[model samples]
Target: MTSDISHVRSLTLDEALHENPVGWFQYRLLLMCGLAFMADALEVSLLSFLATCAGADWGLSTAQEASITSVVFGGIICGTMFWGVFADKYGRKMAYLAASTLITVGGILSGASPSYGWLIFFRSVAGFGIGGASVPFDLLAEFLPTSHRGQFLIYIEYFWTIGSMFVAGLAWATLSQQGWRFLA
Candidate 1:
């Protein structure tokens, strides 16, 4: 009985290590997800910063600025509804990739926006990317085994928080150095 128990323990440890191999693929996947989370946080933070800039630069009233913020959130809601269903029908990898692409395009367009309306439109598009990313983010949690799922999900959240903080720091640095042009 003692020998049998030892053998079982060794086998379990070996299987655990093998299943969670440390390789370039896993690192790349983690980095990709981390970047997605960073983009998600950056978009929301940029919108908040843009509101103040827009209000001052474009002569927008408080109410109008608030509406701009609300529109971005509304876009996020629509995106979640649109992408979540499609991700369920398709696959998480593709959904994640598409979300990243949307985010990149939105960022570029927002930087080039010449008017308040244009900025708001691009902001909404970025919000859509964020919402789409969330679906696959949840799917990644489900993809892992029960034992490691919780740990990985928690790690993902930690990375997300890190990304948020990074964006906040960047905003502060950019604004301090160059002012509202940082929005562009």
Candidate 2:
């Protein structure tokens, strides 16, 4: 029989993935997911620095400072639940956009907080956004070939260390002489 492209057999999803070569698209997906993970890590690590500087500036008691952390964690818990369900119902993309919007708005306003109450409120907002960390990770993993999934997932996790280090450097550079708002 003469060769013909029309005779090509359809590959199963697994077969297709295994047969396909890794390329820029996969690499780009990894970069995007890793950055999202890094942002999540940086925001979580920032909790202590913001609380300390704000506490000193505002004369907040130890319990009050601790409350800031508590509220953020609380928001994280709630957001994880809400976003997970939202992702399940609407879509990961929609949930991610909503979460990102919250993070941007909340984090910026956090720096502008004038009182302990406002600080906690904005941190809660950011924490809620941070809770959507799994969305990008899941989205990336779903797109990656099975062979590359584990390695890429691990690489994505390394962004957390990078984020932690980044936050520390930021605090060291500006926390001492700067206003809480500036360091925030």
Best by TM-score: 2
Q: What does candidate 1's lDDT look like per residue over 41-126, in tens digits?
A: 77776767767876787899999888767867887888888888778778777788887787778777877778878877887887
List candidate 1 segments past 4 Å from native: 1-24
Give candidate 1's TM-score. 0.79
Candidate 1 local Cα displacement, residue 182, angstroms: 2.6
As a whole number from 0 to 100, the lDDT of residue 121 in candidate 2 is: 91
> How many pairs collide in each candidate, listed in order?
0, 0
C-alpha lDDT score of every prediction, in listed order: 0.71, 0.84
- Every model's TM-score: 0.79, 0.90
> After best superposition, candidate 2 residue 5: deviation in angstroms?
11
* Clashing residue pairs, backbone N/CA/C < 3 A, model 1: none
lDDT of 2 by residue, 139-180 (tens): 777777899989888998999899899988988888777766
lDDT measured at residue 54 in model 2 versus the true structure, 0 to 100: 80
Total clashes in model 2, counting residue pairs 3 or more apart in sequence or in different chains: 0
